[model samples]
Target: MASIAIAQTQQAQATTSAPSAAAAAAPAMQLEPTSVIVLDSGGGSIKAGWAHDSQPTIMGNCITRPRSARRTFVGNELDQWGDLSGLYYGYPTQKGFIVNWELQNKIWDHVLSSSVLEVNNFAETSLVLTEPLFNFPAIQSAMREVAFEEHGFQSLLHTTAPELSAYQQRVDSPSAQEAQVVVDSGFSSTYVVPFVQGQMLPSCATRIDVGGKVLTNYLKDVLSYRQINLMEETHVVNEMKEKACYVATDLQHELEKAKQRPSSNTISVDYVLPDYTTIMKGFVRAPVARTGPANMSSDEQLVKLNNERFSVPELLFHPSDVGIKQTGIPELIGLVVESLEEAAQYYAYQNVVLTGGNARFSGFQARM
Candidate 1:
């Protein structure tokens, strides 16, 4: 949390510093028509900031009850806790949709009122929040009431996450100069929304019921069945997946290599579980030669991994691997575009952009 604050401070250091001769000589900066406070929250995370900023300040969007900590932690406060074993999480959204506004409102209050964001007067800022592609009418109505009557914002522009991603795609992909297909696979689900000149085509947008949570759970089940039981270690399992999992370009070929003779396999690795007394967190350790227990170099327990690494992430491309009938990530995008006008389809196909946390998985774009 301190690091995040420091980073944001550093980002504005130049503008906040004493005015120089160059600064005095330069023309006064002009504000946008709307002094927008862009906030986008999902089931598990929140990305928010002033519209003028280059990037957003992201923080956990859920409240958690960890066995190690006595008091419940909410939002960024979760980062301050230690010994996060056996954490049972409570979220505002279920199955990618917000189901509990009380929790949602509490989190939003923390976000808007906390010193982290420092928005003095909500009435002075134009609020822009991102909603799910298929938002419930009740959720939408409640959100507007909170934004206007409760918080008293000057203005509000509530929309979908894909719309924000698509706008960002335009800014980042200057060469594209056309419509785009935004592939956002976050914690709860995957959404495919097309943007034509920064406007979303809601009629053609589609969503897939798969995401990081499902992927992680699927991986855990496979590992538990074949390697070890991790059913009670959700916290550790999630960390292991983030630190070690990667989307492989060649699924069948990699699986074959994984099953080959030990010397011929490149995918196999040893993940060193952290010794809480010395090291606070677990990590993927460099390959160590397997030997008797007495001959081990470190006390950290090492778990041998092979096919699990490649097979888990493969679920995104082949949901059928987990018996999910939904289409793959790329196929979902193709499904949305094929419904568009003939001319628009070409631009949408060429300018596809992936967003959300799962998009960070290595070789994900390559697989797409």
Candidate 2:
């Protein structure tokens, strides 16, 4: 989780230079914690809440139109729509960068005006918004204009999410060394960022093109080829991936185990497909003894999963499996650590941190 901190400036600049001794000694501007709002926007979701709150309110970062209804829903509004199957999704971000401001603006308006954040007057609230690392200067300028001119915020602080994560670590462990490496795997891509003395080394940062979005799409394609066609059911497929998929600690061992007969294979299981009426979301069916098809219900649809559960997540470890031509995350982290100064390498390796939605995969830490 990212940490919230108050800045002395109204419009905080992204800089690497340290403050002068006199400036550092001066008292900083104070603001009530309740008056500040922290918004951590990412390609997959947007996390927002008051600065004093322990947890941020998370919501999807897209606008959707359900197949059953003609009305469109923004952000968290999709929860109200019972039928999530075959929903049409419009995302404001692509490859971890915001590209469609028109769609993004609508989602932002809904989040700020609705009960999620409930900002009655932007002028009275200070905004602490997070942006992607290595963001374009034009996008940064546009964000400032939107915050000050469009939203009329009294003050604004722009920072990256990884920086906040590193800051939080420092706060949690004050005795720990300052050198650390943050592995951020999100919707569109994964980044290995190294921070030294609370500052990031942008030139040494590495990026991998695979993330949760790619994994979900890969699972969709594989399932479509093997069983039912789920080309338009991206939402349903994503839910299924989250509930069933897991990282493999030993790829070869797991593969050999998965090749066994379904009756004896521990990795093999059936995923119950949602019918929208009885089940809103798909679930992993409990293991059952069956000799033939007669034991299964005719009305229920089950997708038999075996090697796919581990093979899909394997792409993160070896993109070459899909011909992406990039090194896996573990090797990339090693390369990043070696590229740093000799003195910082040891501490960086010792303080490595895994974050983002994709990091929640089972056995992810063990695999790393």
Candidate 3:
């Protein structure tokens, strides 16, 4: 868990003379929570909305150019495209860090100026932006320039995602302990962070290279080798991973079940691939008894999944399987706790928090 700190910076105007009596009598302006925009910028998606909203609006963080279309789509515009095959994607961030400001500036322009966020005036709105832990100084500087100079925001408060998570935990459970450990498994990597009494310990934090993007790419490779050649279909394969994959509590037992015949294998299932005509997105075709002749009228494509479902997600627990030489999330969390003080270790272990997109896996909590 990381500590949350809100520090707003505003530009000061240079005045040569004293203020007028009428100006001095007027009250100073203040930013309300409803007028502030909260943006959680991630490698895979951007979670943005007003501070007063109950939920954040999620938008894809990458720009895509479809093979069928000549023009490119930015952020949420990809949803309007019907054909999703062979989309060449351009990302503003790489490995969880902002490197391409040119592309990111475009995304920000679209997000702030377009109807997505409905920001009427950038100069009047204060922004609460989140960046990754140990972010580059150059990137941070660029972000400040973008917010104040490029977008002309009235004020900006920079923070990290884990910090916000810790703050939310305190708000939700005020009677809970003071120490917390946050495991943020996102697109580029996973981070294990510790916070004690609302203060983050940067030295004790650890990171793993495995994340949702690696798992999705691994699944694509396995599917391509076993089924049709889907090397270019990243968009489709990502959806497949979300719809079909899950963590396994008993890895060896599940592997054994997958080894059985298809008729008797309980772990095996058929994932119907999208044809972009009848089915816009793929679905898991329910297992049916083959007691009669097969229906010849339907021409749907399918990929048979057995061990790949659980094996892909297993990389989070064992990055060694993919030759990453780093410890998994569980070991990483333990290492962070061991590095902390004895008094904080107990509370950190007791109040562990799991966040990010990967935490939504079907059996993730059970596996943990």
Off by over 4 Å in 3: 1-30, 175-177, 287-297
> What ordering of candidates by TM-score runs from best to worst?
2, 3, 1
Question: Against the hidden reference, what TM-scores do the models get?
Answer: 0.85, 0.90, 0.89
| Residue ranges of candidate 1 with Cα displaced over 4 Å | 1-35, 174-177, 290-298
Q: Is candidate 2 or candidate 3 better by TM-score?
A: 2
Question: What is the full ranking by lDDT, best candidate first?
Answer: 2, 3, 1
Query: In each prediction, how many residue pairs overlap at the backbone (N, C-alpha, C within less than 3 A)?
Result: 0, 0, 2
- Alpha carbon lDDT at 90, candidate 3: 96
lDDT of 1 at 248: 92
Worst 10 residues of 1 by lDDT: 1-10
**Candidate 2: residue 298 lDDT (0-100):** 77
**Could you give candidate 1's per-residue lDDT for residues 162-183 as a string of tens digits?**
6555544454566334667777
| Candidate 2: Cα lDDT at 23 | 29
Highest-scoring model, lDDT: 2
Regions of model 2 farther than 4 Å from truth: 1-29, 287-296
Per-model root-mean-square deviation over C-alphas: 7.6, 5.5, 7.8
Candidate 2: worst 10 consecutive residues by lDDT? 13-22
Task: Output the TM-score of candidate 3.
Answer: 0.89
Which model, 2 or 3, shows the larger lDDT? 2
